[model samples]
Target: MGEWRDVFDIKRDSAPVEEIAARIDADSTVKGANLVILIMAIFIASVGLNMNSVAVIIGAMLISPLMGGIVATGYGMATYDMHFIKKSLVKLSFQVVFALLTAAVYFSLTPITTPSPEMLARTAPTAWDVIIALCGGIAGAIGNTRQEKSNVIPGVAIATALMPPLCTAGYGIAAHSFHFFGGALYLFFINCFFITFSSFLIFKILRVPVCGGVSEAHFRYQRWFLIVCGLVVTVPSLYMAYVTANENIRDSQVKSFISQDMDLEASSVVAYELDHGVLIVDVIGAPLDDQEIERLQASLHQYGQLRQTTLKVVQGPASQLNQEQVQEIINARLANELKNDSGKSYKELANQYYGSYKRDAADQNLLRSLNRQAPVLFPAVRQISGGTLSTLNGEEETEGRQWLAYIVVSRQLTADEAGRLQQWIQTQADMPVVVNIQLQDTPSQFYGNGIDWNP
Candidate 1:
């Protein structure tokens, strides 16, 4: 026991209380350079999240001063320094407000409104996040108290990720998305509380001296109060963590069940979403019958986490006949019509040709309108071909029609441009239309003077 005590003693390398206090004193005051760094960090993190760049996000994390205020607050609480605690809290609050405002302004001005994976990942906080924050906090406190500080502080900053979640919350606010705002804010709260609480615990364990002379009773009361506050913050986090863990388990079980039992040749799962004890699975290629679906649902009981959950199977929209199938159907119809046009006049033959096929007057009008508008909308477009296909539902192709357009373009269309064209066409037709664009490569230019350039 004595050997173990000597080996595990934290005070052996601990810095003096005065030194630790001075180091965090400047950090606890949010002004000048500290304030500037906080704002810059927020902007960097928000941009990284908006662009979905992990490297940029990590760079932002390294320079973030958000952890300073949190550590100061925790240190103050540990030492029962009222002045220090009050200053730290005020500075921390200011840092949070400024960071959030800066992020919101940046996101509001930016044109890219799509949510990236990096941003989305911060919105959901699990029990593992709380655990990580707590562990990081302990590490941060230990590092701060060391006589010779290593890179542990910066590593803690990156691990805790103090800036990203706040920026994500700001994104939610800027985009007017309450779901994103709420989830991200919750995650940020979890990080702040757990980090501070863990720091307080570590400082107390290190036996750091209190600032002022106080009675034993008063110190004990303050310690209990801090403990209560920590407990209050932890309860909701614990519950949220449990819920997140259960959800992960459920998702894993569902994936395992599908991969192990489902027939991949006949059908394959495209996507799935779980909500309120229900799993909605979207499958393509082949539809599952009632009996097969029931068997699959029964098989889910083997996973204890999903025993009471309901499985709802939905067929994917892409299960319909593809471009090849549509072309085949049109070719067969045209062949039959040509074979039977033995005694028809020129005008009659034209009418017969149009009527035998599924191309009606409305379709022709729409096609003419598209051709007239295509060149105006996209100057690079060389030619356009469009046709209608019977809608496929389950094993049957019904009278319902869907439009398909094939565009030959002189240049490759950007994602935004393609999306805009598709939207415009769909609006004009007052229905959904699938547009596929093919780029026509331009020939390379060559000079006889041993020079070749392609643009």
Candidate 2:
């Protein structure tokens, strides 16, 4: 047990206090080679962010001296060296400004204006980023105290990501977008604050001897300023965390509703998105008439997450289907199912999806034919729409082809008129359909509230 405990013992391979202090002092300055490297790193990171290249960004992080300066600032605080604190702060500030300006120039001159995924990623600093910065700072400080210099510093630099956020802020400046500017700057500040604070904690825990410096009064003012800044940074992250959690929960609930509750058999829901309070659904396979759409919109009320969401069902025009779009739909579905069943080939899945689509398309054509004949058959009939449906028998798989029809007319239909229209529909469909004829608020539109079958 003692041996196991000793593994975590931090003092076992401790560096001499003098050596660590000397090392931090060397890292604190931003001049000569450090300045040059900072410039190069800034340009590289900017290009990486613009191109959305992860490898280039990681390469840039490996060479960044930014973390070194941050650690020096933390070390200065631990030792109560007000002179050293002021010096390191000035150097770090200079380095950050130079880095941001260099990145801004590159982004401004370059023709690439689109914000890539890499750039967008750094703009949002979440709670996890804070935790990562803290862990990295602790690890880096412990590494600095080790007798044998390890690679922990570079790894921490990569993990905390000091360079990318600044570059993103630069991009924001170039683009003249305050949202991007504010968000990226906030993220960079989060990284800097936590790294310095956590490193201070580690250095204090190690009990490094105080190397006194001039201007203790300045350090006190700076300390209080940092405390205020920390609070300012932290409050927004807490609110952002709440919003992120809420969105995740809402997403999960909506996904569950789509999988379990959405009951359109003849049609397939290809894609869906919840924008604000509106749910946009794109579907293909069988036809969808007014009633199906209304039922679909009504069903949103059943799910708590979707109760306030407005549903918009989009069906492609009844022209020829786009094979490529259908292929994308099929591929998405098979990607999930094929994970469990490796034996199924893409060809087989494509064939199955297309076969179903062909049959559905034929049924849709039949419905359209009936719609075209409606006005001639009954002059008062303003609109007619329909869709095909399938059903099952008790404990048996049986073919139950059902069709639903909605007819809208300008005026009321008598019993004789309604009967004649129903017979004409059955004859046109060439199938027995159960349609409930009703009289309500008269028809002025295609889908909602009004209708009769005859003139």
Go through the candidates in order and give the clash count of each: 0, 2
lDDT of 1 by residue, 1-455 (tens): 99999997878898988898888787666778977887788888998999999999998999998888899988888888888889888888888888888888999999998777788778777777888899999999889889999999899989989899999989988999887898788888878888888889888998878878878887789778867866766677778778767766766786677668665667765445455678766566667789988998998777899899888887644449453443443344344433432111222323433542445556678888988998898786677677776677787857477778777777767677777778887887777798767765543223111111231
Model 2, range 97-145, lDDT digits (tens) per residue?
8888888888899998878767777766788888888899899999988
* TM-score of candidate 1 on Cα atoms, chains taken together: 0.66
Candidate closest to the true structure, highest TM-score: 2
Candidates in order: C-alpha RMSD to true structure: 17.0, 15.3
The lDDT of model 2 is 0.77
TM-scores of all models? 0.66, 0.66
Q: In candidate 2, which residue pairs get closer than 3 Å at backbone N, Cα or C atoms, i.e. clash?
A: 442-450, 443-451
Off by over 4 Å in 1: 215-217, 264-293, 300-302, 309-320, 323-455
